[model samples]
Target chain A: MKILLSQSLMAYLSEPWPWYVSGGLIAIIMVLLLFSGKNFGVSATMRAGCSALGAGKINDFFHFDWKKAQGWNLLFIVGALIGGWIASTLLNDPEPLALGSRTAEHIKSLGLSLPKESKEIASGFLPAEFSKPEFVFSFKGILLMVLGGFFVGFGTRYAGGCTSGHAISGLSDLQPASLIAVIGFFIGGIAMTYFLLPLFYKQILFPLINELQNSFPK
Target chain B: MTKAEVISWYRIQEMFLFENFHMYGVIGTAVFLGLISVQLIKRFKAKDIDGNEIKFEPKVFSIPRYLFGGTIFGLGWAMTGACPGPMYTLVGHGYWSMLIVIAAALFGTFVYGIIRKKLPH
Candidate 1:
């Protein structure tokens, strides 16, 4: 009987929970944040960290009393990191991760190759072609990482939030700015996928890959 | 785990628009909306512990700034699958390379602080 119970528990942990379950949990957290008179966001934590590091002396933007206003946000991010560790390790799914067929086909259509086996797909969450040391150390990878990081950091601050802050929290509060920002996020995503991405792969990334291969002769 | 895999997910779902098409995203959004609505109602109609009316003012609204900021943010999101929040998650999941993005993002914020005075409201 004990063995059977253990098996069932393991099974439950191995499967992904239905969408509503996770969603409900997020809702509960948001309500708690609202009652506490705190805004929900991650980017604000960066500002708080900057202030804590004494960035306020140089600029008014980071000059606030971060301990009083954003202490909770700092704790919140720590909690998220801890929570993620627990989820990924303790409650990790035993089965291989799988992508939707349409997603895989679309990637292939973009001139990228995917591993055939389910186990390979699962372990290859970041494909080797891009995530491998050679690729990351290459000029193309460095540029993408640096440029992309700048855009995300600057953009989130300028916009006043990110996917979680604006789309989930701000939209929940029915803020007009969040709504506008969310729409902008969608348009930008579509443009990148259809326009910028293709051009990038064809002109820059592909050439880099070829050059690297030639230099190594592997 | 990798940037390419992350980008593929974006193509399938189109960022936060997943709420419009996926059950998980919708459920999450609905939950937030419900809770936020209740909070708004309480702020307007209910009293605090000391019988004082809660004064919750909405954030400042600026159309042009939001549009510009949001467009740039969207472009960034497209380039990187992990946002500020998920970047932490990625690190926790053992993708330490995400630290590069996080570092760069913080630097970007620092630059913004230096130049914010010059940007129009």
Candidate 2:
């Protein structure tokens, strides 16, 4: 009986669930959060973390009773992390992820290419070039990772919540501010992808790519 | 699945660029349904498990704050191809490089905590 149960669990993990299953689960969680009188946001966890670490002494923002008020949010982050790990590992899909042809063309247009050694590109998930230490340690990588992180951190707090909080929870509550914020997010995204990103690639990345290609000659 | 394929879908970068809208549609619909359910319960004045009335209060409106924050957040999203919520998922997918972005984000938050008093509330 135990063996049967384990086999079923393994089978369940191995196959991808329909999109609605996850969507329904999120909806349920959101409903629960609403009834419980708690705001569902991920960025706020950092504030709770700061409060737990005693940042209240320096600023009123972090002065909340984190253990009583914001503790559960921390657990949510942990759960998300654990859930992701389980999904990626135990239930790991044997097949490589598939990419839409349009997306492939779009990425190619951006002058991005995967390393030759990687077989994952055909499957369409993560690019080895982007994930490698050499890429991350490069000047362009540092700019994106470091400066981008700073922007996300400062912006989420300044705007009052991150994507999940504003887009999901705040939108659900029908907050006008969230609507405006979402619009702004889209505009920024469009501007980056169409204008700023291409400009960066042309001015900075192209030169790097050229230099690397010349040096490697493969 | 290949890491690149997973990252693309999870981050939804190409989708956003190409206007696929599948990711947005799913999230928006689910969230909207959740919102409608909450509204329904509130209209009925339903009590939670603890018997407390559910409240949905809109936050204060600050144009400048929203504009600044949203724009910066968008920039970060574009750069990293992941937002705060998805960042954890990226890490869970074994993209350890995401740790760099996460650490930097935490530091940014810490910095904000230090100087928040000087900023407009």
Candidate 3:
């Protein structure tokens, strides 16, 4: 019975739903959050984590009553992680993620590798070349992860939100700051996609791929 | 998990790479719905679940502030190919290297905490 139930569930999970199904669900979540008098974002969890660990003694930003201010955000992240695990492992479709032709072409043009395409490497919705440990622990990987991570971390806090915070909730709230932030995000994204991204591939990742590649994401 | 993979792919990958219109379709739907919902709620003066009057706090707009911040975030996001939310989901997806990004993001947040007062809000 359990196996039968899971099989049916898997069938539903694996099929692609229309964009509105997900989009409508996302909007409903935002509406729910608004109705609860809470704003949503992912980066806020860092502050809560720090405060929860009593980092407030060291830093005022972390010195809030995190249990009151940002406790729910932490739970959100925890739930996301566990829920992701369940979906990735148990409820997952055995077939690899299907990439659109354009994206596949773009990945190849940029010299990026996808693990889903490679039978030996196992990954879920991540670029094998940039995300796998073999690349992560090396010179190129270190630069990419460290520099990229620093930008994400500092930038989100400085701006008062990340993608979800600014783009989803902030915009939904109809704030002007969010509009500017959203524009900036697009400009930066475009610059990276067209300009910095090519340079990174040509100067760093491509050459690094030639020189290394030892382990997998397992 | 489905949300993370499907949504992140469209949001970060497709949008950044200019791959297709699907990302736009999805995001636009959400934003449109959200805009309408917010308007209706305000028009009705809907109270929150706690029965407090729902409010939208006015943000101080400075051209340089959010622009710089968001651009920096975008660069980081493009390089990492995952934003703050999906970084955790990627970890659950078994991309353990995302831990490095997670640690660095926390450190960055801590750094921001240290200098929060120095920067203009």
Candidate 4:
């Protein structure tokens, strides 16, 4: 029964429904946001919360107590993470996303070996290597996590919002800065993933993976 | 009733879950409509809370506040996959366990509110 279920589920994931449905739903949300007199900005919600915290009191972060503007925005941020996890695991849904064979080969060329038998790198279950708590807490892993956190925080602020805010909401509103920022974001992402990330992953993260694999019981 | 019963219940529940699954298209259309709606509202002379046009203005924006506030936002976003807009949608889709991130976000906000007095401009 599980086999039959998995097969049909795989077929469904291969369909284009995931992208179409999720994208449409977000568009509906964008319209709702404009109606509410609030702009859809993920980063601004954080600022409002911080200012409400009294950022303006000590160093002039919240000069007017922006807390009053705060409402249900933070709740949205929490939902996205939960949504992504559930989408990957519980739903067992196919995302219809796959790295092409050439791209797969390219990924292998970077020295991070992928499973040869895997039809598509994207569809595979989460790697067992990543499941270990020690891997998450290791020197390189922890540094990656923390540095990733800091860079995202600083970048979102510098760019005025994260990708979704600029790409979805700001673009919807035809905001010029959001356009430029969104372009910069994609450029940055491509550059990091293609060039800098590979070197870092191989030199820094790979050894950590090897060490953790040895320590853990397979 | 029991674990097995709960599993059965979930199976039954799946029958009701809308599986249109048109993820990207739905998101794109919704955003486009939302933008159009905002434009319509503004052009129709809709009175804002302050009776002004719904325009984006930089003069009224505080750079320092924006910078600091944005940092907190980016940090949370990086740690978690979802940002503001997607968060609620996730909840509506029944990812109830996400309440943890929501709680942390709220706590972060509450902490900032408490310290608003000591922060720099």
Candidate 5:
């Protein structure tokens, strides 16, 4: 069983053709968005939904009146769902990215409590605890997530756009603010990973890692 | 590059501010974008139909709002390991399941809209 799994995983990882295919598809989508006089931004799409539900028409950010413009964002969601599933299932690369040992240790220090099974100390990430449904719905988890969502929404509004608008659209358009926002994003991401996070986990993440390592195929 | 060209170049630099770096990129991007957006509202002089620009003037976002919002976004980002835009970029690359985040994001937006009138803006 182990051998079979490894072979399949290796095969998935070696599939280089998908990268090109996916890249091409994204370019096509970009062209379509450009032609429509609307930029593609997932964050903005949510704002659109908010407007639809009654956020008061303070701006036309959500007013993509064209019939085709209406549900195009939904297509983006569908596309992403399909993309992630394929990458994980077929590619067999489902594990979180290991940023580096030092980074990982820093994340651990943030009270994230790394899972013991995590191989290196600098793995730059706190293995996902909220990926599962149970964890996601938990009181503490859910509160953090919802509060997080509200923050993102409010932040995007104040920032005049979401990560995408700034990263892709704004960057492409040569917007200075977008440039700064992208920089701040990286800084903020690093600080959270290294500093503020430890205050919450309190060593819980490490034990989970230990449990995971023991269950490894080896 | 001309002055506008220089300015545009500068903007590009600012836009990509921390994308290549670690951690601070997310919040840096957010705040930078917000400030730029405020400037955009002013520079473009974009107005409402009455010939008066619909002021992009955000009265008072407050520090708490900024902190809370940054923390929330950072958490979601850390959990998913992909910010909102990249999530879509991932999809375009064929990560189909990212729709889950997209759906959740949309749902969150809907909920926010319903309660927007009551919230601090």
Candidate 6:
């Protein structure tokens, strides 16, 4: 019986599951959370952590009974981490990420390498550019990392939740705030992809990477 | 594996770029199930492990709050292509770059904690 279970598990993990199955599972997990009188969110863990680590001494926002209110939230995140471990280590497939052709071309044009049409199932989840120490230590990398991190952290706090918080829990509760937040998220996303991203790459990121100012498109 | 959950965000990115519809299907189905599950949980008056009644309070709203916050968050999302949950997944996948992102994010959170009193909730 155990052998049969492991075999099925491998089969399920080998390929992507259909959407409904994943969606239904997410709903079920949310239900379990709600039934236990808990709100589900990923960003809230920061608040809980800050409070636990004595940041309450500095700001009233961190001053709370986090162990009682947010202890479970922390546990949930740990579970997510463990689940991530299982996903990457055990269930991982050697398939190259199936990025869209246009997107693939755009990234390639940026001088980032990806799996070409020939072969070589991408060994890792991201392109090799992301894993390189030189990329991480680059000036462009520093700006993107710092600014990107700050924006995600501060914005989630300012918005009272992140994507999972608003899109899932807030929307499940039928809140106007979540609806507005979700809309704003899409708008921000659109702005970034269409305008800021290309411009940043051309003006600063790409130029800084190659040290070639003439690479800018006319 | 739940790595697909991590991939789903980029699927949204892909959708915005006019690539595909699978992410929409995933979100649609999840949200649909979410609505139903929330209603059922409320109707049944489900209890917790501690035997407390489960409830969802109505959330507060402000026009500018979500607009500004979400837009900022979206930019970061675009920058990283993954949010908090997936950040860990990236680490699990052995990408050292994500640690840099996560560290900066924690520092951001700490700064927020310091100034949170001044921010409008």
Chain A TM-score, each candidate:
0.82, 0.80, 0.82, 0.68, 0.62, 0.85
What TM-score does candidate 4 reach? 0.58
Full candidate order by TM-score, most accurate first? 6, 3, 2, 1, 4, 5
Per residue, candidate 4 scores C-alpha lDDT tens digits across A1-218 of 99999988866654434444555555666555555566666666666655665566754544654645655566655555455444444553333233345545544654423333332322232222223356446664455344444445445555567656776777676766655665555445444444555667687678777997999988
Give a tens-digit lDDT track for model 4, residues B12-113. 111112222222244456557657765786678565555555664432234454445444444334333344444343344343422344445544444454
The DockQ assigned to candidate 5 is 0.11
What is the lDDT of every predicted structure here? Answer: 0.65, 0.71, 0.75, 0.48, 0.46, 0.72
Cα lDDT tens digits for candidate 3, A1-218: 99999888878776554577767777887788788888768888877776776779998878888888777778778777786687667666565656777767766777666546544323346666645567678786787788888888888888888877888778877889988888888887788877887788888777776666644342
DockQ of each: 0.42, 0.51, 0.62, 0.14, 0.11, 0.61
- Candidate 5: tens digits of C-alpha lDDT, residues B1-121: 0111111111122222332232223333433454454456457765543455433222233444334444455444544455555555444433333445555665655555455455543
Model 3 misses residue B66 by how many Å?
A: 0.7
Q: Write the per-residue lDDT of candidate 2 for residues A37-68, one digit (tens) a residue.
A: 77678898867776777778977878889888
* Per-residue lDDT of model 6, residues A91-205, tens digit only: 7666655678887766565555664432332244555666677877877667777788778887777788886788877887788999888887778777887778778888877
What lDDT does candidate 5 reach at residue B45?
A: 63
Off by over 4 Å in 2: A1-18, A111-125, A208-218, B1-11, B115-121
Q: What is the C-alpha lDDT profile of model 1 across B17-52, one tens digit per residue?
A: 332234335445554665566677566775444455
- Stretches > 4 Å off in candidate 1: A1-3, A109-131, A208-218, B1-20, B23-28, B31-55
Query: Lowest-scoring 10 consecutive residues by lDDT in candidate 6 chain A?
Result: A115-124
Candidate 6: give the clashing pairs.
none
Fnat of each candidate:
0.47, 0.57, 0.62, 0.20, 0.12, 0.58
Please list, in the order the candidates appear, how each scores on TM-score for chain B only. 0.66, 0.81, 0.85, 0.51, 0.51, 0.84
Candidate 5 off by > 4 Å: A1-32, A35-37, A51-68, A94-98, A110-128, A202-218, B1-76, B85-121
* Cα-lDDT of candidate 3: 0.75
- How do the predictions measure up, each by TM-score? 0.82, 0.84, 0.87, 0.58, 0.53, 0.88
Residues A138-170, model 5: lDDT tens digits: 654565455544445555554445555655456
Task: Please give the C-alpha DockQ score of model 2.
Answer: 0.51
Ranking by lDDT: 3, 6, 2, 1, 4, 5
